[model samples]
Target: MPAQPDLRSSEPQRGGLSATQQALDAQTALLPYALAVFTVSLPAYVWAGSHAPNAVWMSATFAIFAAAWAAFYGAVNWLKKPEAATDLKMRGRVQIFCALIWALAVGQIAFFADGAGAAREPLLLTAVAAAVVVIFFASPWLPSLLIVGPAAAAGPLIALFAQPETRELASLSWGAIALSMALALIFNRVLRRQFEMAAERETLIADRAGMVEAARRLAQSKSDLVATLSHEIRNGLTGVAHVLAAAAGRNGRGAPSREQLSAALDAANDLISVLNTTLDSETAEAGRLSVEARPFDAVNLLRDLVLLNRPNATAKGLELALHVSDDLASAKTGAALADAHRARQILANLIGNAVKFTVRGRVEARIEQTLSGRIAIEIADTGPGLAAEEMERAFEPFLRVERTSAGTSGAGLGLSLSRQLARLMGGDLTAHSAVGVGSCFRLELPYDPEATAEREVVQAEVSTTPDPADRKALRVLIAEDDGLNAAMLRAVLEQLGHHVVHAVDGRRAFELAKAIEFDLIMIDGRMPNMDGPQTIAAIRALTGHGGQPPIIAVIGGDAEEAMDCTAAGADAVLRKPVSVGAVARAVADAISAGRSEPENRVVA
Candidate 1:
């Protein structure tokens, strides 16, 4: 059996009871004392009035007992005060005071009964009973026991011993005293146990409440995760649909030119990037995302972002402008240590949003170095700007701001992911906007010129010749399970002037590949009968005539897929929502690499 947790440890040591319980305890503790005063005072006043050495002594004794009762009443009132309720010391003092007053009343009764002889027995018995009641009520309090215990035991003896004929009553009085003391100890134990049990119960209740609150938060987090995934996946599907429709010439429009098809492909790729960024944000929230800092030129990065979005701005009849500080432009090295990819992602999101939301006016990007050697990039747009209240909420995932212009709306993860990426790189993204004006997003990143080092530059030969419209077409094989994706792939390949053969599953594709000699084979990562990696392995193991055709694995935009495809003997990997340009590049690169190797030979 598992060991149980000690709940007593969780209970507060001082005043742990709720207000109602404390009030009840206070009343119970004071009740017995009040009753004892009444029980003893009435008899004392009668005795003094009937049998007194003098009227003056009788009046004085009666007056003293009355005053003691009044003082006890005042102490009870003091304990009842709201300020005194939580004061443990004050409560202890009040209990002690009550005990003392009780002791005094018992002592006084014994004094008056001493001279009354046999008549004093009833008075002494009454005093003993009152002491027992007070001790019983006060047992819950430790201080009360310390003061009242001895007084209760000794009060009866005062009257018994003071009598000259206490010989017969002495034994009986001692037994009563012993019995009262025993009851006090027993009741004290019981009361202490009660308090401990109550405290334990309170502790368990508090723990249960905490667990409930935690469970609620976890459920809410799960809900948010589902919402984010649904929104982003829908956006990705929309991008895929737009690109495919354009490739198939099904938009009730003329055939899309190569540039338009390329733009659509770029849009699809951007959607994939957004999904990857969302994953990055999740990793960041879990504290697992790490930054890869290296030396990079900030000027070149900003220039690229401006150029990339310039088309979008122009298409919308909006001016795109860039302003770079002279100092930054003229810096000898112009290098900064940062995560260049993440920085680009943040800027892309900001610039993309600016272009998407704006209609007629210009979008301007400004770059400069701060006094503290930090780089600040600001993108200002004349879009229907965000309202003041919408500014902060804009960064919350799945929260989309309503715009006046009927432009495309997103999953609202872009800004949130961008801000998280910026902060992870030891930078921050902030925004300033007004209702009718415009919005400006500022990105601030640490810039360390002192740590800047010389970076190696590699240049590639540029090709200015236009692509030929009548290149040699090759036989291409495609294995995909998704119907829409297969159709899209076929459309792209045919548009590239290639003869295409489609297989619904990898098993059929492998069989067809063995029968026919094809120039290229494309396999989807997830397909019926066999996955892309398994199919690649099977194809590589096959005995072929003209060597195995160059194989390309089409997969989701994930690092794991790329690694798996490479490990499985694929020549190249293409991320899905495949475009004509990507397919052409993959084929050209694979065939070029194949030409350098012997025919009918697997490299591995």
Candidate 2:
């Protein structure tokens, strides 16, 4: 026969009660029914004792049975408390203990009734009924039933079988008791299965609801992001278009004033800043954001950011000030070994936000070296500040403060991306704000004195070299799929005095490279018909002087993509939104490096 599942089993189970917990619940339900049986049994015992030969002993036995039932009831009530409810082992032991007591008390009563012979049949029937009730309740947990069931039934059978006339009656009673216990076991199994099913159903419902809620939240977040981007982009482009139209005399204006030009530049820069921040946030989330740590002049970078932000501040009628600590002022160099690009990005965001929000009073930028030899920059503004709750969520991506007016435009990624960059560079960014009292943001970075001296020495050595502008004009090849981008690059190269050859794709650029030995090659990282890296690799595989020219990869991705371009034999990597000066310098550097290498050799 297959082994019966142990009703006493207590191994943990998910989405439903464990075996022990089920057993505890069974015992708890049985308590009230057991109490009623004991209450009625007391009166029957007293009446039987009055008509018995050993009446005094029977009465005393009845009193002890009452006391045991009282103790059992107390234990069950105690288990209802929060602390004691989970003690499954203790609860099981208590049920076993009570079962033993019940068996002894009822068995003795049945024996005494059979001996009295006055109310013999009636009392024996009552004892059997009481035992059957307990067996029904205790069946859910087999340990209790195993001891109590047989013992409760055995006492009456023995008493009746002792008399020759009652033996037939006892045989019939035995069959009924066996049938009752069987039914109880079957009922317990069916009920427990139902309970488990209910528990599982509840769990499934909860999980589905949670998934729906998460999907709803994500959809709402994306909608808000789209709305913010559209608003900011439209406003910025409108300002730039208006200024340019005026400058061209198309709007009946002779020439653009200095203020108009500055406003236009600021508007265009704002659009770029918003786009970069959005890209950085996505890159960071994908774990592809790279930090290139190097030594740079922190003091100079902060001064430039403050100077750039002053025009915006003055236009808003807000005072802007830059403060340097005595130590930093005397040293004249706040050198930090970190990601210079990301540091500039963080400080610019902080300063820009300070100026943009402060309608009156002043915006201040403070630079200092902490006692632990770390560089610290704090941007404070006298703006309509944020409340405690709003400040807490300031660094959350895509979160815009409700205090921002309709005129103020942003994509809500500046603070979030800035903080991520700070931590990536082995530093931190923090903020302090109070409603109506203004706000302050602090950025901290690692400092290195040796890097400062090294930078200064390199600067002095470079000062003695010939200017890149004095170099002779050279042939430059430009590979870009976008027409406007190619035109802009061609214009910049021509203005720099280099003869430029334009290719709409990498295939054309490769063909041009094979036919003509160019002094430099600038290719886009991504293009149709042949990507930048693939073209560069193919060019490098060519024979003779076809592959020897210096190659520069123009990318619009994070540092990981830049590394990919360089791996394919490119000499340098330049990111998109390139300026005239940046292009001129890249051209000069590539040409200078190419001249130093052998003609028939390829760079790898």
Candidate 3:
């Protein structure tokens, strides 16, 4: 078996070939050398025709045409590659093609020189022919045999019948013919071997690419299978979780044993996690992960990450710290885009492993400016470092070295997902580690200065004393699809003392909007027959509902999906697993904002 690669470290390939370009460059290098050695009488360019009438009019045409054919053959060889070849080699092939044509072109210009054709004809033709014959026998070709074989059998007859110089001179011509044939025969065999070697090298390269492509397709197929199964499982689990909770609630607490209930809940949570991660892996592999770029404070985002991970890090006895580098202001451009959740995942994975592996030593996160003006985020852990072999295999999917803490394990898709996410956002992940020495993982990303300014979301302070004005009942319209989920939601809304009216889906939601006046519309993001956003847009198109309902999107997807709802006229968005208090607050706000001045409609 081949040795496993150290994925954690990639000393980015020398010429920056992202796998595709390197292939083309390899073939380009061979074209020029092939062209130079095949110089002939007639030639012009890679896509152009030959020099002049005189140059190709003679037998020298055969030599020039051979060189031209080789250049075309070499070029097509490179073009079929998966990636474009880069740098000097790409240009060199064209140069050699042009130079060969230029050499033939000079022969044409010499046609105009006085007495040149007569004086140069015998010497130049013979000299060039001698070189060709020498090179042929020295490095012969398959086709050269036809030219050499016949010349050997006809030499003596030609001298005696045609030339008739001195008898001695005829004998010399015969000998010259024999020598030429001997050399050409030997050279053709050598040429045959050289061509075979080149062909083998080409075949090897092609086979390697085929393997890589097959691996890619196999990976894609696996991701699709995971995604399909995850979706099917999740649809089942959503109903199961809610039904179990409802059943447990109605069971008077003691019907099912506490241990049994607890075990069930734990299994549900684990399944949910597996489903979410599988979805992430599948979407990421398909390159379907989309980002919603909104302005949000960089420092605040960092603080949120630290706060969000605080509970887990604390439970693991890990030291988690957040630091901000001041140089993020330098990456000034609308050109830069980073998915905040992706960054969080990338960082969380690094920090999570750091804390999980380090038994007693510290895990620290340090933020600093990268040399390239991008943000450099590092998570370092003082744990047992990896062996040289293990280091390379760390980031590869489904690979775990077993050098870390016993329970610190995952499907191995996490780091691969993390790295690809970083690259998609114009950043890269790299790690530095030595045997017995701690490891440092670094992520460099383009920082957008404007995102911090645009996303200003700070929770408003809540007063301890409830005001009489806050007691107002609000009119709410629930647009949900699943009958069971809707019932669960209505119970929560009705308990909060809000008047609730329900719609089956987007079509019914639109009908409900057209017929009656409501303070708020709790619209489901994904609904058959027009969807939530479409329903909201239809409502917005009409003049008034007496008071315009502030539509809150009950989203089934992530924040990026929520952004699309907001753009389509939703006032706010909440995910499907929204808690009771969150729904009540949304209802309260929408009602207060959309209420008529003095209409007392049981108005909370």
By lDDT, the best candidate is 2
- Tens-place lDDT per residue, model 2, 231-252, is 8899999999999898788999
Q: Which candidate do you rate higher for TM-score, 1 or 3?
A: 3
Better of 1 and 3 by lDDT: 1
Q: Model 3, stretches more than 4 Å misplaced?
A: 1-212, 215-267, 292-295, 325-337, 352-361, 382-391, 400-410, 433-439, 448-452, 456-473, 484-499, 558-564, 575-604
**Runs in model 1 lying further than 4 Å from the true structure:** 1-302, 315-346, 359-361, 366-377, 396-399, 403-413, 416-429, 443-466, 469-477, 493-503, 508-521, 537-552, 558-573, 581-604
Hey, what RMSD does candidate 1 come out at?
A: 9.7
Candidate 1, poorest ten consecutive residues by summed lDDT: 456-465
RMSD list, candidates in order: 9.7, 8.0, 14.2
**What lDDT would each prediction earn against the true structure?**
0.70, 0.76, 0.56
Q: Residues 1-604, candidate 1, lDDT per residue (tens digit)? A: 1122222233354435743244337545666566665755686547644653455654666788788878887877776678775655556556666667867777776676665444567767766666666666666555466567677657678667766777468668777767777776786666667767776677677777878987886587567767866765676677667767866879977766787677665666656665666666666666666666666677777887788778779999999999999988777765666777667778878888888888779999999999988989999998888887788778886566755423454556778888887887888999999877899999998887655633312111122221656567889999999999999989978877889999999899888888898999888888878888888888888886423788878886554765677677778777666666667666666777663443211110
Give the Cα RMSD of candidate 2: 8.0
